[model samples]
Target: MNTIKDQDLSKNQLLVKNIVEHAIDQANFTIKNLSKRPTVAMLMECENCLTDFMPVVKFIADDHIEYAPIYDQMCAAIDAVQMGEDLVEIEFA
Candidate 1:
């Protein structure tokens, strides 16, 4: 995937980036990882952490078909992770 270097992000991309970073921080995680946070499970370490960020995910997913399904799958995985003893490998349809 292509990466936008410093000072090259569009307003929308920057907004999304800031939201993701805020979610990650609110989950008590460090930001030393890569930018390709394709999976919410990859960004969050635990179910509670994912739960903490669900509101932001819902906000982003609302009315955004491109991201809604992805968010839905991650939300399912989060519920599964919380209820079961296994990590669900849920993916976008």
Candidate 2:
């Protein structure tokens, strides 16, 4: 799992992580193609928000089991930030 600096996570990270986690959990086919791993592009209305998150994560996962938990953790971290809470203990299984 990757923990991006709090200062470097976009508002859309929360949304995108949520969406990606859902997709991973629900995708019917085995995610066997490492070269075609799912990519998430965060879209923001404000350029400032767009500038915060790192644009991409490479070598993110080799399969769904690895990807799902990480995506869930990322979403949880972003949610904690949005709720005015400290993300002091975020981790993936």
Clashes of each: 0, 0
Query: Candidate 1 lDDT, tens digit per residue, 1-93?
Result: 765565456866667756755664544342222123424555455565667677776787784555576567557756655554344443334
Off by over 4 Å in 2: 1-63
Clashing pairs in 1: none
Q: Model 1 misses residue 21 by how many Å?
A: 7.7
Best by lDDT: 1
User: Which segments of candidate 1 are over 4 A away from where they belong?
Assistant: 1-9, 17-45, 89-93
TM-score of 2: 0.31
Return the top candidate by TM-score: 1
Among all windows of 10 consecutive residues in model 1, the one with the lowest summed lDDT is: 27-36
